[model samples]
Target: MGRIAAGDGESYARSISTSSNVEIRRRTRVTDIAQRVAKLMWQWAAHIVRRKDGRWGPKVLEWQPRTGKRSVGRPPKRWTDDIKRVAGIR
Candidate 1:
């Protein structure tokens, strides 16, 4: 650990990160990037939903800007919208 820290920090950091990723992949048995991202997003959404404490993240998700007006032909996609699209309504 000391040798790694004393050597090239960037390379060491990358190796550690890569090793953790491999461990996660082996544990979950999922390798594809798309699936991993989707799975992680779902997990994050579920976590935010289950939180009892009042937090800005969940509040922001539920908040609707009252004064905002559309300037373009189509509205931008939101994080929740993508999640719903991928997983379907519950």
Candidate 2:
């Protein structure tokens, strides 16, 4: 009778061990999939933002006078000498 009880206990222990291993493998696979999805989302968002922003094309500006003869308008989009000077670039 004692030997039979010991065999039952060993079988229960083995079952628990196998179940734990299966659970661990399932969790690892889920984590790997989530990481892959996150990386793809980041890349897609960056691409969309870049497309919305204007590319490296030339821009034309029209100058006009503001109140009290003050010359004010949207500056030229092209990088100019003044911009380089202020930027401390030679």
Candidate 1: tens digits of C-alpha lDDT, residues 1-90: 356556698986786677876686876788879887988998988898888698787896776646677776877767888877877865
lDDT of 1 at 54: 83
Instruction: Work out the TM-score per prediction.
Output: 0.57, 0.26
TM-score between candidate 2 and the true structure = 0.26
* Candidate 1 TM-score to native: 0.57
Candidate lDDT values, in order: 0.78, 0.52
The per-residue C-alpha lDDT of model 2 at residue 58 equals 23
Please name the candidate that would achieve the greatest TM-score relative to the true structure: 1
lDDT of 2 at 78: 38
Candidate that would win on lDDT: 1
Give the per-residue lDDT digits (tens) of candidate 2, residues 1-90: 234475589886776577764486685655566566756755654555456355532221122224465356964443244334644767
